[model samples]
Target: MLWDHRRRPHAFAGIRLQEFDAKAGRLVGPQKTIYHGTDLALVEGPHLYKRGEWYYLLTAEGGTGYDHAVTLARSRDIWGPFETHPQKHILTSKDHPLAALQRAGHGDIVDTPDGKTYLVHLTGRPTTQHRRCVLGRETAIQEAYWGDDDWLYVKNGPVPSLRVEVPGTRDDTQYWAEQRYTFDAALHHDFQWLRTPDTDRIFNVAGGKLVLTGRESIGSWFEQALVARRQAHFSLDAETVIDFSPSDERQFAGLTAYYCRYNFFYLTVSGTETGKRELLLMRSEASHPHGNLEMPFDEPVQLPDQGKVKLALTIRGKELQFYYAMEGQELTQIGKVYDASIISDECGGHANHGSFTGAFIGMAASDCNGAEAKARFDCFVYRPVQHYTDRYEV
Candidate 1:
């Protein structure tokens, strides 16, 4: 069942179960609507669990503010006419000693095979001067149980630390294998392109490339052509071969880390005066012009006869390295390392707080007049690194 909080009048605040046919492997029935309205403001992190005769729908709410909390609602049927806790804010900051000074919310509930329930949530770090809050939100785990009234409760307040046993690790070699995604028409619906996307730009699906006709160069204020997916601390590699002979010499196309219009890092191929290819990294701000970090390759790696060349970016922690591959081999290491810290609040940069959201990887092409450029993305793969395993129990 998928919940849509963007319902009209904000009345449909609960769950909506879409019936599906196992044989056909597709949705089958008219969707059944459950929870609704102010009761589920910005409600997310929904996990359904069945025990005995009861089916529970656990969710997080409170608008990503200091008052954010985790709550519960249950029903006997899967498509629930569910009932919430008599008292809201079941698993909240009030229960933690450190919560009063900071804030914690957006929690996910995980139950063990042994029947132990745990809550994992994001919290702001505490410091002497509260003015400086790093965007790096930390995740902590705690033990939880139901009260007499059927309300969920966590041990300790604000910052609970339940000494629960960590689960055994799985054989990750089989799990870490690369999975391939073939570009299909059905992907338009299955994949979430963005949380909040600019409606003005049109994504040319037929052209096999996302074309951005918008004037904003990803660093603009009103509308920037940016699309990303959830971040999970994984290593990703993608190549886009582009043909840019349509315009005179003022066209560009490549990969970027887009936070917003005023903040992002991009590596692109621009037309030089002599009609040669030049690789450059552009960073911009609302108050200043684009900052270009010229990354000159040994020679101008020309796009194939198709007028398209492949570009790739590899992310490893605070370092995002760029590369260009022609044929099947990497041509030159585009000597540009974008310090992820610059766009991260943790390293003292002016950017939004990175809460539950992860970084997104995608391609972009823009600023061409008659010279129609087409970008063909050969492949995109995300593989988890060993470092993440060292940091978290996952």
Candidate 2:
């Protein structure tokens, strides 16, 4: 089952799960949201199940504030305007003794082969200043059993530990990794990511490797001209070899970590006044208020006679390292190790609020005086540590 959060019309909403035919690999139908609109806040969790002739849909209600709860809806058919309990709020802050003080929401439900059900929901950790959060929400398990009316409920309310047997077999611990995609094939904007993308600054997908033309410098508030996916906790290394001829001293082309319009890190190569390639690092914060800092290369890196160079970025946790290679040899490190946490929400800052997708690695080129600079990315690669025991199993 898949659960999605809908946020439209100025209020928190509910979750929706689609039921599909496993064999045909197509969506047969979907289970609609049981509780919706401002009444439920944001219903983010939806786990579906079939018990005898009845179908149960479990979800979390209330906002991410202090009054979140787990609720249930039931229907005879997989798809329905489900019937919510008259009491409405099933699990809430009042339900748990260990809830501390903040809200609890965004849960996952899992069922074992032995017909046991458990709910895994996220809860906030309180701090002195306020309820500042990382992705540090903890998961709690609750014992669930079918009631007299054929609905499911936690046995003794929201306990810290449900004490239910783990549903699946044990496996060795594995680390999560980032998945990288190259726009080498037909270029289309239909690909799925963690969030919707800005369409104006990104283009070109015909041959291989996506070509992004930078519109403004990295410090611009609304027109950086870079498109990227969101970066989660997983570490990633993105490398792309770009070929571009600098028409003027102001032309630049390279790779960047684009969090949003105002928060981004870029390592680019531009033509110098003296006709040499200069590698530089530029960054911005808070809608580009501080302008940009340029760390210049000690010596200009010579590009291929065709004026092409390869740029790459390696991101591990909160650090982003940049490197440039010419003729297949690492020639320069563009800048000091960038502390990525500074621009992330975890660091108590906001720049790229609307760009919540995963970290993206693509090429960008920019020119002055309306002169178009074409960059060809020979290849792009992303390598991440292995994190899944059986990726296909899920």
Candidate 3:
């Protein structure tokens, strides 16, 4: 808490107090150094709340990793010296690595009409043992109450509880309901494509089907025909029917379990150089340099002259498998079971907490031929399967 030039190690990593310019409709002016904590190291995300005579200053520190926590400070005056909480951190999962919800911090407090205090914070669910956050960070709430000493605290203290009761209604039926999209009139709300303002050049919805005009390769960071939704469950099923005719090996259109260019499993309806239609499986991992694709099947499955193929993927915890079916036949498992953990936060683009995004299930089309062939998808279904958080049988 000292203000000596020799005491601070880093530049521009502390919490500051700024003023809002009402006339300019923006925040302006010089910043004031109210709290520069060297003990907690990486301090950021400050929120101020006033209750009675105490001014509470909450900050998220410890680098948003396993050691992430919520540090609270308070003072009678708005600008003088603030004392840290008795326990320092008011909400955290740092010590409880095995907890169902992990990486708890960067939170805000709320009060309800029932006169109860609650804190909503960020959380994550990692796969067992490997500790990969497959779902990235999620939101969680905890019951809180004012302490006798005038400090705010989480209900049970630092470690966040698995479940907390809040003043709200939760409908399980509607929460876990299946969503089916036909793409009849226009693009559905759940679907999103790559970053590009010129969407009309990549995809369009016509004749009750979502059509993708093959553009850049699927590994493209910009302007790729990849439409997808967030993978939000630990166990789930995703199915889509696509009719794509790739003239050569340079073209591909089908389903993909994607994380980034370097981490994904794509099952596509591609063609050989001689123009023979077939099914191909491509795998890429973090270890692969330059984002190269690994063709798994020595002999790709030959497809019939008909065009429609149903592509699907099922994710159970850390395992992912792909399936395919013809027009009137049942779905059949096609490729080998993949380590779904690879398409997660830890294994996404870099190792050691570099990436912090979840996976996505989507349809993609790539054409290096410059022909802009069309790939039509009629329906997509997302069905979530509830399961125990722990690696155990229900």
- Candidate 3 similarity to native, TM-score: 0.92
**Best-performing candidate as measured by TM-score:** 3
lDDT of 3: 0.82
Can you write out model 1's per-residue Cα lDDT over 188-232, one digit (the tens) per residue? 432344323543352444444444442334444444344444334
TM match of model 1 to true structure: 0.56
Write model 3 residue lDDT over 207-289, tens digit each, in one string.
99999999988777777888988888888899999998888999989999888887889999889898888999888887666
Error of 1 at 181 (Å): 3.4
Model 1 / residue 332 / CA error / Å: 2.1
State the displacement of the C-alpha of residue 148, model 1, in Å, after optimal TM-score superposition: 7.7
Q: Model 3: runs farther than 4 Å from truth?
A: 1-8, 287-292, 350-354, 388-394
Q: Rate the local accuracy (lDDT) of all candidates.
A: 0.52, 0.56, 0.82
- Report the poorest 10 consecutive residues by lDDT, candidate 2: 347-356
Measured with C-alpha atoms, the lDDT of residue 95 in candidate 1 is 43
TM-score each candidate: 0.56, 0.58, 0.92
How many clashing residue pairs, candidate 1?
A: 20
lDDT of 1 at 33: 60
